[model samples]
Target chain A: MGAILEIKHVSKFFGGLAANSDVSFELAEGMIMGLIGPNGAGKTTLFNCITGYYPPSRGEVIFKGRKMNGLEPNKVCKLGMARTWQKVRPLAKMSVLDNVMVGALCRTNSLKVARDIALEQLKVVRLDRKADFLAGGLPIGERKKLEVARVLATRPQLLLLDEVMGGLNPAESEEIIQLILDIKKHGITQMVIEHDMKAIMRISDRIVVLNSGEKLAEGSPEEIVANQAVVEAYLGSEH
Target chain B: MKTILNKLGNNRGFSPVAISLWIAALAGLALFPQFVDNPYALHVMILFFLSTIMGESWNILGGYTGQYSVGHAAYFGVGAYTTMMLMQYRQIPPWLGMWAGVAVVMVVALVIGSICFRLRGPYFVLASIAVAEIMRLCAVNLKDLTNGAEGILATEIPPFKIGATVVTDFLSKVPFYYIGLSFAVLTIVATMLVQHSKLGYYFQAIREDQDAAHALGISLSFHKNVALLLSAGFTSLAGSFYAIYVGFIDPPTVLALDISVQIVLICIIGGIGTIYGPVVGSLVLVPLSEALRSNLIAQGIFKLGLASEESGVGVFLKENLAHAHALIYGILVVVVILFMPDGVLGFARKLFTARNRGNA
Candidate 1:
């Protein structure tokens, strides 16, 4: 399958500090691409650049043959790219269902229709039972699920998930891994930033490792595990 | 009693019962002036309607959208000045001038939104107050147009006419009452439509989290401005109503910081982000202030035999309570903030839910 998203030599600098430097990657259609990196590896920064939260200092983010440079995050989302924050920010006072409805409303103007779509997405994430509860009252595990459900309601062709599994326990993480696999079955392209190596290795069709704001290695899961440079990048960071 | 009230308030969407209650209320308000001929009563009702319009308008942007502008008086003053100036200087009728006021306020809202929306939190609040202060200063100093501190008094309001038939002259308070009622109803209906529409969801999302909303394809600046425009437009209408009905327009009266604070207080004290929040706020505030101002509460205390008229407590109440309206108002606000941080509606909801849990 052809690439659904192409990031060409993207670089984001914040006042001379390079948060992301010369990062390049392509996410193929219907594939789960795991983006693994140590702390401050510019994973979230790259997600920001792709999602148009911040314009890259230099580079092109081509989404389905359209240039996404300088577009606002909302415009980028309209073009079939949606992202979650590393820190899940749910509409605190709104009900869990209403929070998802906000995302679904982007696809349709009718609240009734949006609610239906939102309910369906909540079921997909197994959060349908807590639909009436305010998003603020949910625990971390549920909130992460809610963040995923909300973005999924937007019906994006490409979803960039920033650390959805960060603070989750092993059981919750397993559920999310299964959820990601299920999302793949639906033919949506996903680029996930994860710190949990085992989880990323289990779900990713392809793995890309980053170190010091640059792409360190890119390959299949087996090749990535075998790559000497990738191993060194991980071990060196521990020191 | 609490459970019954909770059930009624919790009934979401348009059930048959809700629709009937709404129609009955609207009808009652429409026919109020015919049954009541007293001018003082009519004047108080008119003030109630004006307060409702201001509160509801402010609620749109501040409550729903989470853009708490303490500088709404800028638009209010602009609206009042626009109508009063056109009427006084060029012989334009106020009915025509009110629309002009709305138009000017829209432009003013856009300009203010562009500047203030860049800042967030308390910074945004301070920026709004600063902008409003500048407008008030302009009104005070720009003697050429605004007529300076002496203020503009509407010596006459041209009789409202439709096709050569006089609808009503400005002679009776009843005409102003009906106009105020209609404007109040218009604002309430407008707020309801927004609450049910896609716009309301976008506003709430932005209020909850701007970045998250944007990632969901919600344009933050665009939607925020849309809210402010709607809010400023209706608030200008209220300003126009106040100027015409009171027959006075001054920087102190229309453009002061107190006017803006009062608008916000109405929303905050009632309950923010709910349709009836402002309505409840106006109902509580307008009457309480009036009663306090007129020493009616003190008189009522004596009449109820709570205290002898000549007793030390009664004399103190009679002497101090009338002059303590502002102090009492301040105390009420502090109490509400401390005990009921979510305001009255939210506090009531919590109580109802707790009671239900106890029953369960």
Candidate 2:
């Protein structure tokens, strides 16, 4: 299908340092694009630029057919793009249902309708049983799930997840992989920033590797694994 | 007791008994002026209603939206001055002038919100205080518009009328009492509507996490401004009511930092982000302060035989107790913060639940 999101040579400079430099990519509709990078690889910075958390110092972010540069994050979200933070930020003082209801409220003005959408998304993440529990009191695994459920309630066409499984156990990571696959079945485009190699390979339709704020390589999973440059930049020369 | 409390707090729907209780309470309040003739008692009741309006208004922004502005007096003072100016200098009656006050307060809120909402945490607090201080200074210096620091004294309120008939002359405290009561109720109902609506959810989301709320399509500036406008509007109403009731306006009385802090204390001492928090807070604070100001507490001590009438302690109590209300308020706030971080209402709820468990 056609591309749903396009990053055209995007670069972000914080004072003298370049957090992201000329990173270019396109996320095709209904596809899972894995963004793998080493530490300080500018993955999260790129996500911030694309999601309008920060305006890129250079280049453009086109969502659907509109230029998204310099737009606020809320405006970007309203235009069918949503993102989750690297550190799970749940509305701690609010209940799980209420937290998700806030996301669903983007689509409707009625609290009841927002609540129903929240409940439906909660069930998808298997968090329906903890609907009344405060978002802040949940364990990390559950907080990750809550992050997913909340963004899902927004009904975004493109979802960007930043290190969602960073601290998750093997079993939890597996569950998230399955969840990502399930989301793909819904035909929503996704860009997953992850450090876990096997999990990324299993879910991504295409893989882009980044090293020190620039794209190292981009290809199918097998092509990326066999590419000497990607292996050297990501796994080191000894690998 | 547990069952009754649960029935009262139930979210399925309003219980019949609860509804009846509310109606009865409202009816009693509406008819209170008929049976009471003591001006002091009426004055105290009006003060209670004034406190309720201020607390409820502050609770919308500071409690629900987590803006925690300590500069609400800017809106309060602006409202008072606007209404007073129009009534004293221009020919407009206060009833019409209060709406003008609300409109003026909205513009002030927008300017303040734009300046302060850019800063978060302690910075936001500081910006709010600075803005309010600036407003207070402006009020003090603007001689032509605000009558300078000399203040304006409204000699008399015009009579209320409907279609050629005078409804009530502003002779006794009765008219002011009803007006205060109605505005207080209006603020309470407005708060309830906000808490149960989608706007409340967005506000709370911004409070909990700004970035996450933004990622969910809730604009921080937009919602914060909305909260401030609503809060400032109600607070302006309280200001207009106070100005008209007391017939006096000055920088210290209406626009001081103390007034702003008092508005916030009403919410913090009751419970923030809950419907009845300000109500409970106002109920506790107004009577306590009134008693202290009137030296009733010292008299109660003497009457209860805790201190002899002619003793040195008695002399001290009678001489200094009335002026020590501020000190007492400070100590009370410290005690509440230390022992009950959730405020009086939350502390009471916790105690009740623990007692119920013990019985079980």
Candidate 3:
């Protein structure tokens, strides 16, 4: 089959600066693609363009063979795609479990249905223990996990993880990598943005690199480490 | 279902406790006026029930969706003016005039809601205030249609005397009492129905987080307008009740800023969004207001020798505390907000939940 999601030559301009310039890629079914770059490589800008947070100044973002241009983030979500913010955005006063229940409301109007789904999703994210606790009391790692559980409760066909593991310890990072794989096992297509080269290499089936809002290279990790452009863009003179 | 419901706060559908309580309250209202036929007491009850209805209606949009609208008087004024004009000139019964009032308010609220739903948070609040002011001003300046500040008035048409327990004179306040009580109960039940229905959860979701709700495929504008229209329609009914209860209506001061703020204040005091918030709020605020008013003017510690009814120092307090009464209400609202943000009932619910959580 064709790719599950296709970003065809997308260029998102914020005034004169191209936050994402001519960024193009695709995620096939069952594929876990990694989008990585040095800080400010426009990796997130590309995700935003695809997810309809920012409509590309040039070119279309297609999901499951449908155009996603000029769509609001909510509409994009209804199309069975969901994303977490780079920063946590929990409803502060609500219980931790209720935060996840919000995603289920998208698909079901019944609080009972939403609650049941949110509960199971929380268990999957290992957040069931703290479900009754107010979300404000959660640590950053648990908060990130809560975000993932919230998306899972929405039953999204495509899941985008936006630096959810950014602040985790090494052990915490490995657990998240496994969680990503487990999520893929449930037949959801995945794209994760990460700065940790080791975690990205461990989970992603394919990798795309960006530099200064431009696509620098696209290859397997082994090939990417060998590429002169990738090394120069990220490693500089470290090696 | 119970497990999930507890996890997510109250459940939908008719909980047995709510149904039984409503039924019992209705029965009591049907008979209570028999014992107490006093007109002043009747007037107090009328205003109390009216505020309850308005609070309940506003809760549909404000409490459920977290859309804090301060200008609800726009809807109330439309209802009042619609009924007053139709009854005065067209000679329509308020029974029919009330529906006309309802339609006008709903259509206007829908249009405003559709446009205003786009603006989030503080912007939406500002837009709602602007719409309410514009509507009020239009009602004021349009002298040809609305009679400007010169309002409509009708002499009190007492209910034609009926059976023994209910006389046509003061004896028939019973029917009006029943009707007011019915509206109060109906508003509460209607709020409950929407709370448990599929739409209620959508409202809760939208309130909690709009973007997250939208991502789940919920239609933001559709549900909000539905809520706003429903809220407007019900509130206008209360306005119509106010006109008939008083036998007169005016544009400028009769249906003004104070009317709008009073409804919300009652909701806040009772606990906004919760089922009994309006009822609880009306129960507390209305009686307190009445107490303040009655006690300000007179100077005697009067006691009604009737059974358990202790007549208070109402007349003297009414004379002396008129200015202070308004200030007291304002101060009370501030205290409630600062000390009990969830509202009076909301705080109570928190206590209940905390205890339950601990026991678990």
Candidate 4:
């Protein structure tokens, strides 16, 4: 079977600096691939390039057997790709349910259908309790969960989760871990970028570690943690 | 009695409190002829309606989306001049000319919006201004067609008479007054529709975060462009009406930078991003300025007196009062941004939501 998303030798440069250089990876059907990198390893930049926030200076991104090069974000979404931001971008004045409804609006024009789907998404994230509250009023944990709910509302076939576990407590992390697992159970392909090793190791079927804009290693969870180079890179950064 | 009150409010097209206030204001406006039958008063009132419509037209784009444009007169001028010349050259009735103006302006707006809607924040605002100025210059220099700076005049006929009432006379202005008022209402209702629709949610999302809106596949360009079209259509209609009511068309009156800025000011003062604010702003600012000018000119017994040789001081005071409205508007904007941030309707909405929560 073909990979849901394939990034082959794609590089993006900002004037003199290469934000992403020869970065390549793929997500298979129903597979949760972990994209792990230190700050500025260009993980988010690579995501942006794939998602058409920035066009790659060279190379191609293939999504679902189509050349996904320089496609606008909305078109990319229409083609069954969705992403959650590292920072929650909920409409501050809108209720949490309404925030999700914006995403649902993409799938259905009917307000009732959108609202129903939004509520169901909120239920998946355990945010049904706060459905009527303003999104901006949510605490950090709830906001993070709300971002997940927002993406879910879009009903994407391939979900890109950016730092969904970045600043959560262990319990919140565990909750998201189960949510990711449940999402995979529903046959959605997932790619999560997280620094939380425990959560990543628990949920990711495969992990790709990036350092200095290059893919350092890609392997099973245990292999990534056991790789000599991965250990060296983490220790070298300490020095 | 409660049912009767609710029915009366529904008929009046607003809540009871708002309906009564509107009725009282209209009564005050009708009684103005007793105090001043002057053309100046009529002139000011006509300007009032134009500003009101421009401000309300702006509500769809600026107020709803929170994307500010300071160059709305581009559409207004397009509407006014396009229909004005159509009527002058072809002997087209101004009634038909108004619709033609609306169509022309909406097409132009769709094109402009398609190009410029991709830009956001201050970039969008700048593009709107530059485009409006370009059109202004084009209208001025398109000499053979536009009569260059010399403007086209509608061959005047008395107002469509109802049993011997020639109400269309610019001097009478009552008919013009009602026309402007209703157009303003139409703009408001159109805004209210956008606000209530799923389209409104898309606008709010795009305003708050563009990437998020796209992630949801709301198609920002398409929705924003529609908003700009709706806004342009009404603004152009007001412009065509201006040509008919003023019975003369000129570049400055239709396309000036001040005219664009005045709409923004009206929206800001009345309340930015609100359906009711523009109309309220117009109602408050427009007549007050007119009344102030006349009052300043007429010295009262033991009240404030103007002491200018050329009546320059009186004009200065009157103009200052207009400027003062802007000052009040600016301060009000700061206050709203700092305190209410949601705007007048936005604030009211919040209160309603909170009160509803308590009731529930």
Candidate 5:
């Protein structure tokens, strides 16, 4: 299939520090691209640049062949690219259904239609039962699920999940892996920033490794595991 | 009829009994002047309605959208001054001039929104206060336009007319009461519509988490502006009403920082983000403040034999308590914030659910 998103030499700077340095990758349609990096490797910053939360200091992010350089986050979302935060931000005082309905509202002005979309997504994430519960009261694992359901309600063509499995138990992480695979079955392209190596391997069609804000390697999961530089850069002296 | 009752009952705790009670209360309020001919009681009712309008207006932005604009006096003053000036100088009736006030407030709200909405949290609050203070200063200095600090005083309101028929002669408190009641109802209905709409969800989303709301494609600037416009418009209407009813408009009276604080207090004291919160707040604050200002509270204390009229405690309360309404307000706010951070409605809800659970 065709590439749905292309990141070309994207670099982001905060003062003199380079948060993302000349990172380049292409995400094909309907494929799950795993982004793995060590701590402080600028994975989240790159996601920020790609998702229009911040403008890249250099290079381009072309999504659906449109250059997304200085667009606001809301504009980027309306253009069908939605991302979840690493620190899952739920609308705490609102009900869980309302949280998802906010995302669903991005597509339709009708509260009834948004409710339907929200409920459907809630069911997808198995949060339908707790739809009326205050979002702040949810556990971290379920908050992550709510985040997924919310973005899914936006009907995004491309989803960028920043550490969706972070802070989750193995079972919870397994469920997210299954959810990501299921999303792929619907043909929505995804780029996932995940720390769980085995989980990423199982879900990712291809993996791109980042080391100190630069792409260390990009290949299939088997090829990535065998890459010596990636092994050294990521695993450090332990590998 | 049964299906309609069931529908209303099923939707968000609006039981048939509650709906009937609401209808009864509204009917009583509508017919109050007919039963009670006392001008002082009618005056108190008008003040209650005015306070309701102001509080409900502020609640739209501060409570639901979480913008917390402490500078709402800018809109209030603009509305009061606009209508008063138009009537006193240009010979326009207040009914028409109120629309002019709304238009001017919209422009002012947009300008304030552009400047203040760029800042978040406490900075936004500070910016709003600063902007309102600037507006107050302008009103004080601009002698040619706003009549400077002396302010605009109109002794007579032009009688409203449709063709040859005069609607009212502007001689009675009765007309003012009806006008205040209608404005109060309008604000409440507006808040209710906002609370139940997608617009409210967007506003609440922005309030809960601005970044998350942005990611959900809710434009922070756009939604915040919409909330501010709705809030400022209603507040302006209240200002116009107050200017007409009170027959005076001064910078200190209409545009001061305390005016903004009082508006916010009305919502916070009752509950923010709920339709009835401001109404409850006005219900408590208006009568309490009025009683304090009129020394009725001290009179009641002496009448109840809590203190002998000649006692030092009684003398001190009787003499000083009228001026101590502000102090009482301060203490009340502190108590509410300390014990009921979610405000009265939320606190009441917590108590109600806890009691129900205990019963179960």
Candidate 6:
């Protein structure tokens, strides 16, 4: 499959610290790429650099053959690339449907059209019953689903989800996993930063592992599981 | 009670009852001056409309967009000074000069938005206050242009004419009353349009979470500035109206920090981020302050036989309350903030919902 997004040696720095260094990956079209790492391994930082939340200190992010190095997050979104926050930031006072509608509004100017699109997205995430409820009142698992629904409404070609299944129970995580599979069925490329090994292995077509702000391994889930360096990185971090 | 009222108000499509009530209210306001010939009453109504215009204008930015600009008086002062100066010095009529005020304030709003929108939270608030303070100081120091501390006294207003037919002479409060009323209506309609448009949704998204809105392709600075331009334009119109109606324009009268706070207070006390919030705020504040200033509340207490005018409490109310309007206003604001943290409308809605739950 042809690549939809190419992260070429991207690095992010914070003063003297290198949060991400020489991190490179290629996400193929119509495939789910799982990004896994130990705690503080710069998974989110890499996502930020790719999505235009932060300008990479080195290298480039090429999405759909366009360099997205210095564009703002909004501009990047308009280019059909969108990312979800690790901590879901719902428009807390707005209705759940309205929060999704905000994302739909990215593509369509009409609120009526946006609302219909938002409703369809909410149905995909199975949050349509709570569509009228205030977003802040939703539980964390539902809020995460709402975040995915929101980004989905933007009708992005490539979706980056930042630990969307984090903190959810197994049942909730299962639902999200199913939702992610369903999204893939819609023919959209996805990059998921997930901590759950079993879930990631089940869903990801391929896996890339990072350690201490650099790529440790990149292969299929079985190959990644058997890689010595990937095993050692997790083991070393736990100790 | 408030829940039912909210249900009526929150109806997505127009209800017959709501539409008729609105029409009746507008008709009553239109015919009010003819029935009440008392100049003092008309003067109070004019002040009411002026406050409504100011409050509604501020609501566009501060309420809908969640950019709580404490520097709105900068636009107000600019509009008043612009119109008054042109009329007094260049013999330019205020009708033409008001548009000049709007144009100037648009530039001012853009400049201020560029600076202030860079900051967030308390820093944004502080930056806004600083910008307004600088404008006020410039108005004070620029003696040549602003006529110094003595202020501009507009002793004459050319009669409003349409195609050589004199519409109204500047001799009575009736003309000023009608002008203020129309401006107030204009602001209300403008606010309603913004609230229902895509602009309002984008603004509220920014207000709820800036980063989330940005991720959804909403340009933060661009949309915020659009809101501020609309806000400042209407605010300047109110300022121009005040200058023309009151026949005076001074730094304190037009550009004071208190004026900025009052504009915010009108929105906050009613409800922020709602179209009718500022209107409700003006209705509550204008007459409350007027009654307090005139000691009408104190006199009404005596007239109702609550106390004799000679009694200690009654005498104290009559003697002190007139001057204590500001203090009372402060206390009222504190009460609203403490008990009704979401402002009156939200608080009332919550109360009604809770009571309904109890009954259920």
- Candidate closest to the true structure, highest lDDT: 5
Model 6 chain A: weakest 10-residue lDDT segment is A230-239
TM-score of each: 0.94, 0.96, 0.87, 0.85, 0.98, 0.96
lDDT per residue, candidate 2, B283-331, as tens digits? Answer: 9999999898889999999999999879999999899999998999899
List residue ranges in candidate 3 displaced over 4 A. Answer: A92-101, A109-116, A129-137, A235-239, B1-20, B155-172, B296-320, B350-360
> Worst ten-residue run, lDDT, model 3 chain B?
B300-309
Clashing pairs in 5: none
- Look at candidate 4 and give me any clashing residue pairs: none
Candidate 3, residue A143: the lDDT equals 88
Give the 10-residue window scoring lowest on summed lDDT in candidate 1 chain B.
B3-12
Report the poorest 10 consecutive residues by lDDT, candidate 2 chain B. Answer: B5-14
- With candidate 3 superimposed using the best TM-score fit, by how many Å does residue B276's alpha carbon deviate from the native? 1.9
For model 4, the docking class works out as medium
Where is model 6 more than 4 Å wrong at Cα? A237-239, B1-12, B304-308, B311-315, B355-360
Native contacts recovered by model 6 = 0.81
Across A1-239, the per-residue lDDT of candidate 3 in tens digits comes to 46999988999899999888888887898888888889989988888888877879998899999999999887888889999878877766667877787778778867788889999999998999999998778998998898899888878889999998999998888878889999989999999999998888888888899999988888787777788888888879666
Winner by TM-score: 5
Ten-residue stretch with the least lDDT total in model 1 chain A: A230-239
Cα deviation in Å at residue B118, candidate 6? 0.8
Q: What is the C-alpha RMSD of each candidate to the true structure, in Å?
A: 3.3, 2.6, 5.1, 4.8, 1.4, 3.1
Summing lDDT over every window of 10 consecutive residues in candidate 4 chain B, give the lowest-scoring window: B297-306
lDDT of 6 by residue, B1-360 (tens): 556655756654445577667879999999998899999999889989998899999999988899999988999999999999999999899999999999999999999999899999889888988888899999999999998788999978888889999998789999898899999999988988787668988999999999999999999999999999999999999999999998998899899999899999999998888777777888889999999999998989999999899989989889998999999999999999899877888887899999999999
lDDT of 3 by residue, B211-315 (tens): 656655667888888888888899999888777777777766555778778878888999988988988899889988886676532323334422222334353
Clashing pairs in 2: none
| DockQ by candidate, in order | 0.89, 0.86, 0.49, 0.66, 0.92, 0.84
Candidate 2 residue B335 Cα shift, in angstroms, is 1.1
Please give the ranking of all candidate structures by lDDT, highest first, separated by commas.
5, 1, 2, 6, 4, 3
The native-contact fraction of candidate 4 is 0.77
